[model samples]
Target: MEQVPGGPERQSSTSGLPSCYRHPGVETGISCTRCERPICPQCMVSASVGFHCPECVRGGSGSGHSASASRPRTVAGGSVAADPRLITKILIGINLAVFIAVQVVGNRLLDDLALVGRWPPAPFPATQGVAEGEWYRLLTSVFLHQQFWHIGFNMLSLWWIGAPLEAALGRARYIALYLLSGLAGSALTYLVASPTQASLGASGAVFGLLGATAVLLRRLNYDMRPVIALLVINLIFTFTFSGIAWQAHIGGLVAGIAIAIAMIHAPRERRVLVQYGACALVLVATVGMVVARTAMLT
Candidate 1:
């Protein structure tokens, strides 16, 4: 083969010699780097070691590792991704879609999508916004935002926190933390909020993820001053803001911390079951609180 600057390799044909492996009709003076069989320039694949046949390149299993050199294999569910930030991007997309929807529907969207604490469940309070059985509000409310700035801030928080936290916790655990944190926030709201009020936004989940990130960073022995400072500022804002739901923030933070602790401290042998069980306990506690509150209201 002859070499040229910025051009396809050209092959010098030999009379009555072995032809290209891929194109038999085409005669050439090239050979497979490993098998040594005659080949055409078109079939030659450039490798760090040497030029190889297309078959060897695809199989990655020929002589001198020409065949065996392939891409790294990734496991099914863990650490198997070209881009680790996929879940974070998807979550941001969902949040943006929900925000647009809420704006399109106006007050009706707020009434239906936001979480409202319901009490005196008989005919559902006339003053209550959504119907009595709309339990999904506990989750959907986390994605609903009233104003452009509200969504812009919450989405920004989620974008920052979700990437790191998801990287540390893995997709499944990260999703669990997000959803349960939202539920914890909504449940705490149900326990403390008046039936006349409606609550919405992703602050609870964002705070929960921040708490988880802090814990993970601490576990890794990384300095947590930035995270700690952010937490303190958010806490101060929660308390100082007029309409902020400090209860939801506190509830989500506590629940996230609890779950993160359980997952981190769990033994390797029992980690999966223990992490899931810890999450179940949090959910159960939230449910029990809501039920108890309902009974008291009744």
Candidate 2:
């Protein structure tokens, strides 16, 4: 019934200190790295790299932190290590695995598993028609790729951009951007591509990552010209390259740019919500455009 003046009730056998030095009645077995004091679970605060004790946190030992951990020590570095961007790497792995399975296992299996587009099938059963079925493709087609090169390029880009972006934004926001961007890309493709032509890839979502990066860099007061140049070069290449889905690229770019702007410019705590809402609006607009265009075409 007696509470320690400043410590938690629970005592750590290792330290013999109450869980938290501040709340002696509360039990916190974790110790602070800076102060080396036992911390109650409630009082424990997470650093970018590790957990910190309440005293260390109050004294600001872990504030304004940069990643001191090396690559292998980074969150994705080891099996046991905690990387803030682990989800990004896992997503890349899954995509790569899918690509390998498709190439090695053959298109027959892929077709069976492929995300179907809105268009009805042409004379060929494998080539489904894209009449009204475009809505389904918005979500599914991102997982499907036309060739090894297609998936390979997208996955590589995802790894290059997704990891850092996820690290900066955190897992939930990164995943939201990716999915929304992919959907936006597909929706754009449906809007512009001939209903008779079926297309699939993750380019749109990857572009969204680029957009997110642009926003992040700007928020950090980094130069935007380099990013703009990179985007321009890629867009030019898309136009020149055969079989590249320019519509998807443009769609993703626009969506990503919009999301990034909302995220970077919005109030600090509201950035994530604004970014998410912007992407959702873009998707809805893209779908509406696709539907309207399809009706006009028919």
Could you list the CA RMSD of all candidates, in the order they appear?
16.8, 15.2
Q: Which lDDT value does model 1 have at 259?
A: 84
TM-score of 1: 0.71
Instruction: Write candidate 2's Cα lDDT for 42-92 as tens digits.
Output: 344445544455435444444444433222111111112246558777777
lDDT of each: 0.68, 0.61
Candidate 2, number of clashes: 29
State the lDDT of candidate 1 residue by residue for 134-215, as single tens digits: 6777788887787787788888888888875675566677788888887898788778777546778888888888888788
Model 1: runs farther than 4 Å from truth?
A: 1-80, 119-131
Best-performing candidate as measured by TM-score: 1
Global CA lDDT computed for model 2: 0.61
Residue 104 in model 1: lDDT: 79
